[model samples]
Target: MQDEVDAVQRILSALADVGLDSITFVAEMSSTGRSVLHLLTFGPAVEAGIGPYPGSLILVEGAVPEPWRRRPHPVPRAAPAASVDAALLERTLRERIPDATGATEAEIAAAEAWLGVALPDELKALYRVTRGRWQDWGDDYAAAERVAQAVGCELFPLDELYVASALSRPCPWRFAATEAVVSPPDAAVQGLVGSPGWIVFGDNGGGDRIAVDLTPGPRGHVGQIIMLDHEQNIGASLLADSLTNLVVHQRGDRQSSYRVDQPTAVARVNIQSMTSIQAAAHPGLEVLSIGVWDGEPLSLAPVTGLPRLRTLTAYPGTLADPLEIAKLSGLEYLELGPEEWRVLLDAGAVPRTLSAAGIEVHGNRHPLPIVALANELLALWDRPPISQTILEGHVEV
Candidate 1:
C-alpha cells in the first residue's frame, strides 16, 4: 500500500493532469487507523477524469484505494498566547449582537440585563476574546458554538453529542468534530473541559427515527423542556454559548481543531433534540421532551454497550442497523417521522415501553416518497413544530 503522502500525490497528479479546477483532497485517519480520503470537487470539469483516474466511481470518493488515503487525527496544540481585552470585546458585542450592549456591563446588574445572568469570569474572558469576528467552518450553529467556546463554558455531554450530530442533514449546522472512546462500563462521560466540543447522536443509515434536539435556555441552565419534531428532516441543536472551547472533526482544517475554554451554566434542558436512548453514562443529565428527525442512530450498537437511555425521538435514516433500538429502556415519548415509521410499521413492532403524548409523521410533497412523508408529518401536529418549515413553500428537492 502507498504511504499517506504518496497517496495524496497520486490523487493530486490525476486531478491536476486533467485540468480539474477547484478540486481538493482531504485525508484523515479512521479510528481503525485506515486512511480515509474525502474528494471535494464540484461543477462539470470533474466528469472527464472518471475513467483513467482513481479506482473509485465519481461524484465524490469517501475512502481511497489500496492505502485508503487517511491522515492522522490532530492532537491538541497550545493556542497562541493572546491578550484579552474585556472592554474591546464588550464594545464589539454591542455593535454586532442585536441588543448585545444589554448583555454586557461594567457590573453584574448590566450584564444580567443583557444575558440574564451574572457574567462568570471565564465567560467574560471568552466573550471578550470572540466578541466580534472569529474563524468559522461554514455551519452557522458551528460558528455560534465556536464563539461560545472562546471562554470556559461547556455543553452538557448528552446534549452536546446529539446536537453536533443532528446536523447530518444537508444544512449549515452539520459541521461537527468527533472523537470516539471505548472505556470501561463504569466509565462516566468525563472530560467536559477537553471532550470534543460537540457530539451528535442520530441515524445515518436509511430509516426514520426520533429526532434529538437541545434548546439553550437562560444562563445556560438547561431547563427541562423537550419539543418533538417528527418530520424526519429538521435536525436538532445543542450549542455551546462560548467561543473559547473548540472541537475538531474530520472535515475541518488545522485551525478548527484547537481547544478554547469558556463559561456556561446548566440552563433548563430544552428537549430541542431528543434521541430514543433513555439514559446517559454520565450523571447531571437533564431531560426535557422527545422529538424525531432524519439524522443519526438514536439507539446504541450492542458492541458500544450504551444503556440506561430514557427518551428517544429520531428518523430511521441515521443508523446502519435497525435493531440497535434495544439498547434504550426508559423512552417515555416518541415521534418516528416517515422513514422509521414505515420500517416500524413494516416490522410490526414498536418499543414495548413506548408511551407518547402524541405521534406525528412528516409527509413529503417532493417526487421522492420522503417529501410526501414530511407533509404527512405536518398533519399530525395541531401546529407546526418548527418555526421555519417550508422555505418559500418549496421544501428541499
Candidate 2:
C-alpha cells in the first residue's frame, strides 16, 4: 500500500509540474466493470468516486444521482372489453399458422397462478393457438419467424409472461420529478412507469415489450395492447385497443401521456435563455438551472414560493443568496458549489425535501474540500459518506 501510494505521489508530482492546480483524476466505477478512468483531467471535481491526489485523500462514494421509490398509481375502474372476439382472434392465428404449436389449458392456468394475475381471455386464446416458447421451436428460425409474422410481435411463452409493476422501471428521483402523468380523457393508456395491471405478452423485437394493459386510461379497454418502450423510463404507448386487434396485425399508434403541460417545467437562466430568475419564475416551474453569466449573481427570491419547484441547479457563484434555497420546501434535487454548500450547511439551511443533490465545480480547485462538502450533504440524508484515505509521501524529485 505504501509503495502504491508513493508511486501515485510520484506520478501526480510530475503532472503538477505542468502548473495547473486542478488537474483532477476521475475514476468512475460500475458493477459491470465498465469503470472509466481519466488519468489527468482538468477542472474541479463535482462527481463522487475514488481518485487520489498524490499525498492527499482519494475521492470516495459520490451522492446518489437519483433515488427511485415511486409506486404504481391506483386504477379505480375495471378494464373495458377488447374490441374483437377472443374466439375469432384464436381462429385467426390458427388459420394463419395451422401447423403452429400452442399452450395447453393446464399450462395457461399455471402461468396465471405463477404471475398472481389472471391472463386476459384474448392473450390466453392467442397462446392456446401458438405458444411462443423458444424450446417449442428449437433452433428453427423459420418457426419463430412464422410466429412473429402471425402475431406481429415476438411472443413470450405462457410461462414467461409477467406483471409490469412500477418497481420494474427504475427511475431516479431527479428525472422522475419532471414527468407529468396526464392522460387525455379519451386516451387509451395511462401514462405511468408501469402498472400492476400490465401483463407482458411479447416483444417488438427492438427491445420494447408488448403488454396487455388492464388499467386502461379513461377511454381505454381493459385488455388493450400497450408498448413498454425500452428507451423510456416511464409510461407506455397504446398499440391497439384490444389483444384481438393486435393479433390481426392492424396496428394503431398511441403516445405516452407524459407531457409538459406548462411551458415552465424547466427554466434555464443564462445569456441565451431566460436571462434572469425573475423571468424564469413560474408557479408551475419544476426545475431552475442557472448557467454561466456575465452579470451579477441572481437572487432566489423570485422563485421562493414556487409550489411545484423541485430541482435547482445554479452554476458556482451565480446565486446572490444561496440560503434562499431553504425556502424551497419541495426541492427534490439541488446542485450548487462548495462555498454555497458550505453556506447552506453552516446555516443549517439545506432543504430536507431533497432526494438527490449535486455540486458544480469550475476552474481549477483541489478536490479534498469539495469531497468534505459532498460528505456533509450526503450525511444530511444519512447516505453513505464518501470515504477518504490520506497518504503522505515526498516526491523523490
Candidate 3:
C-alpha cells in the first residue's frame, strides 16, 4: 500500500509539472491483491501519462469507460464538449438565457482578494471570458432576463463575495436567510461549525449554495465543489471532485449505470434524495437503495431504526464496514458494485446471514434499461426459479 501511494504521488507530481492540476486518482486493491490505480482527468490522460509504474492503471478523460458508463439508463442530454471550456459555459448559458455574460479577469481577481484566497484554475479560466453583468443595466432589463426572473440575478456579482466573506450575509433567492460560510471566518471563534475552509462561489437557483473547499476536509479534497444547504443543515457535502466534474454532473453527462424505480410503499425505498431526517420519517422501509456517485460516503446509521429492512444496495465504499449492514437484523440481500463484490468474494468475509439470504453483484453484464431490469427482477421474485432436479424428475414421470 505504501509503495502504491508513493507511485501515485509521483505520477501526480509529474503531471503537475506539466501544468495538469484538474485530476483525481483512486487506488484500489484488485482481486489478485495488487494495487490498481484509476486516473480521472479533465484534460487528456495521454498527455499526463508518466509511465513505468507498478500495477495496472486505467486513465479516463472526459467520459466514463464502457463498463462503468451508464448504459440504457436515459438521462437529460447535454451539448457536446471535451472539457469545461469557455465555449461550453457560454453555450449552456445561451441555451437557457441568451446573452448571458461571464466574469472578467479583473472582477475575478477582485473577488479573490476580497475573499483572501485564489480561485481555482477552472473558475479563473471561466471568468476570463466575460464579467457577469446586464447589457441594458436597468430594472426593466434585469426583469426581462430569464435568469434574473428565475434566480433574482443573472449571476453572482464580484461585489457579493465581499459581503459574503466579511458580513456572511444571506444568499440570494430562496437562500436569502442562509448565511454564506467562507474561509476568512474562524470556525472555532464564530461558532459556525461544519466545513472550515469552504468558499461560496454561487447559488444553484435554489436554497443551496455551490461552494468549493480551499482546505481539504475529510469528505473531499481542496478545490472540490460542495453543495451547502443551510436549510437542510447539509454543509459542504461533496457534490463533485472539481468544477469540471460539477459541469459534467450539471449537464447530466455522467449517468448511473444501474437502473432505478419510482418510490413505492412496498417497504422498498429509493434513498437517492433521502436525508438523515427523511430516513427517520420512513421507518417502514423493507428494502433501501441509496444512489451514491463520486461524493462522500453516506452514513447508513440513519436507517438503523428501520425494523423491516431486508435488502440494502449501495456502493461498498459508502459504508465504513460491510458488517454495519448486519445491524439491521432483517437485512437479507446485499447488492454492491462489481469491484466491491469481487473484493468481498475473495476475502470470504461476506456475512453468514447475508449469504443465507443472497448477494447480488451489479455490473459485469450488458447495459439493460433500469425499468426493464427492475420489472424482470420483480417478476423473478414473484415466481421463484425452478430447480433442475424438479424439472428432470417431472420429465421422467
Which structure among the candidates has the greatest TM-score? 2
TM-score of every model?
0.22, 0.75, 0.31
lDDT of 2 by residue, 198-244 (tens): 99988989999999988888777788889999988767888888877
Model 2 steric clash total:
3
Q: Let me know the TM-score candidate 2 reaches against the reference structure.
A: 0.75
Candidates' C-alpha lDDT = 0.30, 0.72, 0.42
User: Residue 128, candidate 2: how far off, in angstroms?
Assistant: 1.4
How many Å off is the CA of 368 in candidate 1? 24
Model 2, position 101: C-alpha lDDT score = 82
Clashing pairs in 2: 48-62, 79-222, 80-222
The number of clashing residue pairs in model 1 is: 110
Error of 1 at 157 (Å): 32
lDDT of candidate 3 over 265-362, digit per residue (tens):
22322345554424433555555565554455655676776765555666545554554555666644555544454454456544344321222334
Off by over 4 Å in 2: 1-82, 172-174, 184-186, 254-284, 291-296, 362-367, 389-397
> Considering TM-score, which of the candidate structures 1 and 3 is the better prediction for this target?
3
- Pairs that collide in candidate 3 are 102-130, 102-131, 103-130, 103-131, 104-131, 267-286
